[model samples]
Target: MNTTTLTGLELRPLAVPADVSELETPAGHDFATMMDVRNRVYFEISGHHDESMSAAELLPHYQPNPDEIRFMWVAILDGEFVGRAGIDIPLEEGSKTAFWQIELLRKSWGKGVGSAAYELLENKAREHGRTVLQSWASHPAADGVEQIEPPTGFGSIPDDHAAHFYKRHGYSLEQVERNSAFDLRGSFEIVERLLAEATAAAEGYRVVQWEPPTAEEYVAGYAWMKSRMSTDAPSADLEFDEEVWDAERIARHDALWTDAHQFVLVTAAQHIATGELCAFNELVVGKDRAEASHQEDTLVLKEHRGHKLGMLVKCAGLVKWRELVPHSPRVLTYNAEENRPMLDINEAIGFTPIAYGGAWKKVLE
Candidate 1:
């Protein structure tokens, strides 16, 4: 299907190929162009390439998946690609949430391009039975720019172009997230000390580490922890469906990383007495070991809090990650500003705020 606006912008559905080898096809070529535009948007916002993914590494995810449906469209002006947008609808039973994103080159702003694209997105969401739409966008800092703070009172984002656009579209700034980075080449003395203290404090828990394609013994426990992420994490005024996870779900999650040739190190804290995985942390780096690593999904179960398991798993993971991907320059992570405990841990580990983002939401009438 094709959509056009008064601004002479055309929105065409993007086709996903079965594999990267299909790039020789017209659809594959369009997909590649979309990826290029995506990376450019990320770089322009974050001033770094860490968020960039190669076509080969990102293609597998665009293929069919059972858990959700993804639709993408490219923005064309005067027959040249300018940007793209997409919406992901989770297939969980009775879910009303649809996550979406819209991006256009700087030259395309204020031309009614974004408004026209959002019209199509909102219409699609309604067609899919989604009532709540949420999105997060980086609101990079700028001198003299006003800031919008979430009711949580933890972080604030500059009222930049994205903020104005979202507000005009009937979305409210619901939460703010902090983007942080840790220098890997810096000293690890503090990491070593924290690991020791946490290990000593976590009396009945032991640190366990492994790579993706989770081991057989830990799959169930891992699945339980994964499920808890939706509930356990600090989400201010935002809604997430309660996810059900199992061995099959774990496999699907692992393949998205392993199949992309990305290296993932899982550091988990296991209750030695019951052999239950109480807490975990994940460190990931793409095919290029020299680039920045990503810290993904660190959680210490609510029932197991106060044992310092959070610090134990995180520090242990970092120490191991350094040995495994020593060439990686640094590690990057994001957390809600209201999540004080996690932020404390990050700050103590020498991570500092590099940017802030706003989490916005709008409900359909």
Candidate 2:
């Protein structure tokens, strides 16, 4: 079937030979343009982390059997690839949800290309059995290298152009999300003071780390910690899609950590109660790149509260991380923006305001 036409754009089952070669051939140039457009639009709309795109950094997504990607939809206008959109479904089995990320080269906008591409992609999603169509849309902005505050959890959108786009189809809000980050290498004096304060408060708690725990033990520990996390987090009122963090789920997470940095803090008994802290961090480093670590989930159980266990755990992890990866310049984290208490804790540890990563959601029926 003809997947290309002069009438505007066409949608076809993303095939290997055609799609891969097209992307791989001019991958560098294509990625640079893609990155430029992404940064431009995001910077103009909502000030946030804007960086020049490099093809080498994007090559991995097109590499052999990368698991993070689900499908790709390309926009062809006047016989040139003008934009791309895709769904990134984490490979964990039984995950009922998936995420949407869309980018249009600046020149491609205002031509109805976005509408056409999304309709095709949405239909493709249904074919793939997608129950939810989630898209992360941001306000329009000019591209820059500096960081800006991301809009509310779901992104800035009184404009709601994107929301209307989804609504005109069939998407609705699921839940909102927010983000935050810290400067780890700012000043030793400040770091030392934060450490001292946290240490003073953590009288009896001792930090610990280990390889994969026994399946039964891992499941139990995660279950306990997850329950506490749910209630302690800002979303305590929202209905969680998943009930238990079981062994199989934990294992699936472990499988992704081929080069991940993980740490957990526990009491002398190794039991996870309030006052105990746990976190997982993903490391990103390069000589020419800004060194940053993404702090995934930091949890302090209910029983472990009030003693400043959260601060202690985070401090311990930071100190150890510095000792281990001294070159890492900063740490990034995301929490519901209204999560003030935790935000205060993060600020105490030197996490500065970076960008507003709004969490916009649209339900699928």
The alpha-carbon lDDT assigned to residue 117 of candidate 1 equals 86
Q: Residue-wise lDDT of candidate 1 within 265-305, one digit each (tens)?
A: 99999999899999999999988889899999999999999
What is the overall TM-score of model 2 with all chains considered together? 0.65
Root-mean-square deviation (CA) per prediction: 1.0, 6.6
TM-score of each predicted structure versus truth: 0.98, 0.65
For model 2, the superposed segments whose C-alpha errors exceed 4 Å read 1-6, 10-69, 88-96, 128-131, 140-177, 209-240, 243-290, 326-329
Tens-digit lDDT string for candidate 2 (102-131)? 666667666777777666566656666666
TM-score of 1: 0.98
Residue pairs in candidate 1 whose N, alpha carbon or C atoms collide under 3 angstroms: none
Q: Which candidate is the best by TM-score?
A: 1
Per-residue error for 317 in candidate 2, Å, reads 3.0
Residue 343, model 2: lDDT of: 75
